[model samples]
Structure formats: C-alpha cells, structure tokens
Target: MRGGAELSRHTTTVIAGGGVSGLSLAAHLAVADHRHPVVVVDDGSHPLDDRTWASWSDRPGLLDAAASRWFERIRVHVNGRTTVIPLGRYRYRVVRGSDLRSVVRRYTDPLPHFTFHRGHVDRADQDGVVVDGDHVRARWVFDSVIGPEVPPPSEAQLGFRGWYVRSERAAFDAETPTFFDFRTSQDHGASFVYVLPFDAHHALVEHTSFTASGALEIPRVQQEALTEYLTEVVCTGGHEVEREEHAVLPLHAAQAQRRRGNVLTIGTRGGLLKASTGFGYQRIQRDSEAIAKSLRRNGHPFDLPEPSGRFRMFDAVLLDVVTRESAQLERAFGALFRYRTAEPALRFLDEATTPPQEWKLFAGMPAPVYLAAAGRRLSS
Candidate 1:
C-alpha cells in the first residue's frame, strides 16, 4: 500500500532522502498505488527549510498551488548593460519549499502505505539501505543524498547568496521578476544579481558567482554586493533588509551513471540536474514522473533510465568548452538568446522541448570554439 496507513512491516520501495525529489517520488508512488509500501528516510538536514524552487513550465503540477509569484520577462545584465527577454507564453514561477512540504504532507499523511522516518542514511548497498544501523529491505531503493565529494566528471562551482528583503519604498515592478541583472562586473568569475520581486516593495535579491573555487563570506558579501547594486544599478537607495535566503550550488557538467544493483539514484544524485544552469526542481519533477510511469507500466521495480543521450552529449561539450574558456560564456549565452526564441531556449534548457533546427543553430554558434572544446574533451 503506497498511501494506506496500515504498516506493512516491510516495504517494497524505500526512498532515502526526503527532500523535494524523495517526497515527490513518494507522492507519485502513492498516487499510483494504495498497496505498494513506500518509506522515505531523511537525515533531518532537510534543505527544504530556506530555499525557493523556481522553474519555467508550460504545464502545472505539484507546486502549482504554492506558486507565490510568476513573471513572463527575465532581465539579463552584463557589464552594466541590461537585456530584457520576454518569455512570450512561458512563465517563470516560484514556490517555496516550506509550502511544498505542507502540500505533500496534506496528501501523504492520510495514506497508510506511505511512511516517513526521520533518521540518517549511513550507506546504501546492493540489498537495501542502512539507516543508523537499522537495515531496511526493499525491492528498489531511490537515493537522493549526495555529499560534497564525488565531483561530476567535468563541472564548475557557483557560489551564491539570496536575500528576501522588504524595501523602505516601493522599488520593484510587481509584474516581472528580474531573472539575471548582469550589470555587475564580471571580474570575479561571472557575477550577476537576480531579483524575484514578490510585490512592489519586497523581493529576493541574490548575488551569484560562476567560478571554479573560492571561499565566500555569504552574508557579508551578499549584503555588500546587493547594497551596491541597489544603490547604483537598480537605483533603489535607502532600502531596509527584512529577511534573507542563501545557498551554494555546484554548476557541474558531470556524467552520472545509474544503478548500484537494485539501488538507484534520483534527483541531483541521479544526474537529473541540468549541468549548465544548476536547475533541478523541474528536472526532478519530470524524472519522478517518468519513473512513476515506468513503475506503473512495468508493474515491478526496475533500473533507472538514463537521460537523453543527445542532451548529455551537448551538455558535456558545453561544459568542456566553458571550463576551458570562461570568457566564452557571455558570448555563448548572448548568441543563444540572439539566435533562438526565448521559449525554445527555455524549453531546451529544461529538456522538455527542442527542435532539430534549433539544435543545429546551437551547434553553429561559436563553431570553432565549440568544436575545439568538444574535440579536446573527447580526446582527453
């Protein structure tokens, strides 16, 4: 029973890591069956406390009801210049993790077949997963707990800080969320400021860095950088900070393999994350949906399927190119925007929709540089 309250003693599907991916998978499994026993284990260090999950989507799903804000235009800035890209039919939506948890709990709490345990997963093995010496057996185990080590084959790190602030005066447009304000200097790797304006006077401002390696004073640096940007670029002076949000995500272009016997990887650990953008929320949802569909169709546990081969190859080449030459990112991004429609580009990044001609155009941009980087990575 996936959702029934009756304890089955032992479960068939045991998921380790109760974050977005794990919880979502559990919910999907529950919806699929009322008899498949599913248990989710969390170490208590849930990242859901202070993070915002935002992604571009044409259709709505789990987080649709919790969407606090949305925008159709994303502003990009580079070296004091700004470009506003209209999303056309696409909308960039945001939903806080706390809200997501609340929604999942509402549905999952009633089900007897679903159980959530608060504990640490020490290690995962071929048979099952070990949680604080308690061995839990399952036909399939989906793991989402990945640590700092196990670097992606070829990837870069991006350190960033997000702050939710209430301004003293109304300074932001309530209709549009400033996706990337690239007006800041690109000297320290590639730096940018993003604003997710909740209303006219409140927004989540973040200072982001696309660099290889560095220790950052997140709070101090974010405040300072934000203060400077607000006063200079945004011209929103004398604003008061009310609340803050911060995080560091590795923008790695790593090739992740699936399968450890019956144990399978999910979420970022499963290479469901976008290598270039560090966007995993939508990808996680999509991956979980696919897995659920597979389970329903197969009527048994199975090994996880790999992501699109073409997408992986493209990401690998792009990552190699970016790693070898950081300066080309801005140009590459600019070309992508200039050549392709915003909708298609967003779809491509989300791995939802892509056209063959668009891919051709993508490969054509910076042909010499891309080819060289691809060749270098392949040879290496």
Candidate 2:
C-alpha cells in the first residue's frame, strides 16, 4: 500500500532551503489548500538539533505549537551592575528550530500536495532549481538560499556562538531571560553575554558581539566565551553541555537580491533580515504570511515588492548609527526601553512599527555620535 502511494507522480511548488522560513512557508501553503503541490528541498536529512531561537513578543500566535519558554522579566547588566526590567505586559519566548521543523513537517506530511526532497541545491535560476545534478521544474519557485560574499552595507562582520547546557548547583530563575549581560569589557567592539533559562537547571548561554570581522573559529571562540562567562561571571560550574549552536550573521547592512527570475525570494535571502540586530525570524514570518495572502488571491506565486525603500533607508540609518558608535549601545538601548513601551521599541527596531510619539521618543534618545552618523547616512 505504501509503495503504491510513494510511486505516484505529483506536480509540486518547489521551495529551496528548508530552514525556518522555508518550512513555515510550506506549512502555510499546506494549510491553505491541497490542490496545489508544494515541495521542499533541504540538505539535512534530519531536523536542526541543539539550536534555540529567541524572540520578544507578547503572544505566541506566529507559529503554532512552538515551544514557548516565557519570561516576564529581563535583566540588563552594565557598569558592573544589573538593572532588572520588569516586563509585566511582555514575554520573551524562545522556540527550538528542531521543534519547529518537526511540528511543521508532521502537519505538512499528511497532505498529498506536500513533499520534502532531501538534497543539496547546486544552482537556482529562472527555469527552476537544480538539486544534486537533477533538474526539477515548477510553475513557481520560492528560494531562501543565501551565498557568502553578498554585498554588505558595512565592512564589519559580526558573529557569535550559543550553547544549551544544564547545571545542578547553580541557582537559576527560569522566569526571566537575561537580555544583555554587558559585564564583559566593550573594548573588543562591544561584547556581551546573554542567557535564556528554560528551567532552573538548564539554559542557553550565548556570547555575542556588535563587531566581529574576518574569519573566526566560531565554535571554539563561542565555547570559550560561554565557558568563561559561566565560570567567571555567573559563578556557575559543573555544567554539562547538552547542545551547541553557532552562526555568523553579518551585522553590517548586507543586501541580498532576488535571483531566480520566476522564483520569488522569501526570508533572509529576500533581505528581510533586520539591518541592525540580524533578527529575521519574526520579519520572515510576517513576510511569508503576506506572500501567502498574495498567492491565495492571485492563484499563483509572484515577486514581492523587494522591501520598500523607506524601510531600507530607515534600517540603513539605524545600522550606520549603531556601527559608528558601538560604545553607546547600552545607553541607547536603556533610553529606548526606559522611555518607551517594549512593544513600540520592538516595532521600531523591526523598522516602522511605531506611532509618531514613539518615533519622536526614539529620536530623542541621547547619542550625538549616532545622530551624526544618521545624518551622514541621510545625506548619502
């Protein structure tokens, strides 16, 4: 019985790069209908393991069945002291990528219109995507593959490593996520320690930066930084590493253009990445929803508007301000949070998600250097 179904031929809407964006789009497509065929190709046979994705939101309506480790409070450390910000209305949530993949896969697999192909994509073009020397044609393609050396807005390359670990002796309040622990010296281009505790005994610790250029031993460096922070700063010892996740996201303003002519690019490859923070999950989710709505209305895939010039200009200004005055990050962030609601700040960081009052407040923050940088960007 299984053999007969497996041998059946089905037309598919091909999606390349089965990461969060790809999988989410597939799930949306699956939920939308069973008439149109949807196919996803990924290099990994198994779902991504040992990785945690953190996002700040009041509700968990973005992705269904996502693992939501909620924290009503956050701590920001600077100048050798920690300031706890009680976010009664906001909750910081994290979802493991593996969990997201598994849930999406389970939901999409049952649909006869949905299919997943495990292979490496050698090239993608207007015709279709070529996977491992095999050509598969589709009416339309959605691509998320991003290559290195893409033109970046800035010259700096920021990178970091994160790990999930469990400790027995350490005292951990799982109710709160340490948003920023800036106890480390900012001399090395703004370094900080961040943690998200799922339970009293387990947490994901990460060492991140605002400026990390050129080639780096990402795993080794992240491991060392995490261990050092855990042992020396947090005073937590006897911790066993459960898993490790590492990534090098360009903090600089990098422009990733749409390639595959018939293929409409979604997610990071479509330049949905936030120019300042490198956070793409929420933006990509929103982008996917918009694309899905368009497809549903038009009855076919189409190119997205390439992200508005106004949004890009705003992002470029913010990126210029941050990179030029890396030292003022703490003060700038403090002012933003202290003066405005978390919701407005989150929206502003994601681009123009703020009212006029919130925008004025954000603009009023103290950063003469950043203001100068912004002016330069505006002039340019």
Q: Best candidate per TM-score, number? A: 1
Q: TM-score for all predictions?
A: 0.87, 0.85
**What TM-score number comes out for model 2?**
0.85
- Give the per-residue lDDT digits (tens) of candidate 1, residues 1-380: 12222222467787889888898888777776637777888877866877678888877786477676777787766434567788866888888878877877766788977788776788777777777766767777888884333545645656677777777668887877776766665555565687888887888888876655343434565567888888876677578777766666655465565567777778878777787777888888877777777788886545245567677667767766665565666666665655324676776776665567456548636888887877876687
Q: Per-residue lDDT for 128 in model 1?
A: 72
Q: How many residue pairs clash in model 2?
A: 1
* Per-candidate count of clashing residue pairs (backbone under 3 Å): 11, 1
Off by over 4 Å in 2: 1-9, 45-47, 59-62, 79-81, 146-155, 212-225, 252-255, 303-311, 339-341, 358-360
Q: TM-score of model 1 relative to the true fold? A: 0.87
Angstrom error of the Cα, residue 90, model 2: value is: 3.8
Candidate 2 structure quality by residue, lDDT tens digits, 62-179? 4757765766678777656666776655566677887888888777878866877777767666667677776666676888774332444454455667778787665466777887
lDDT of each: 0.71, 0.67
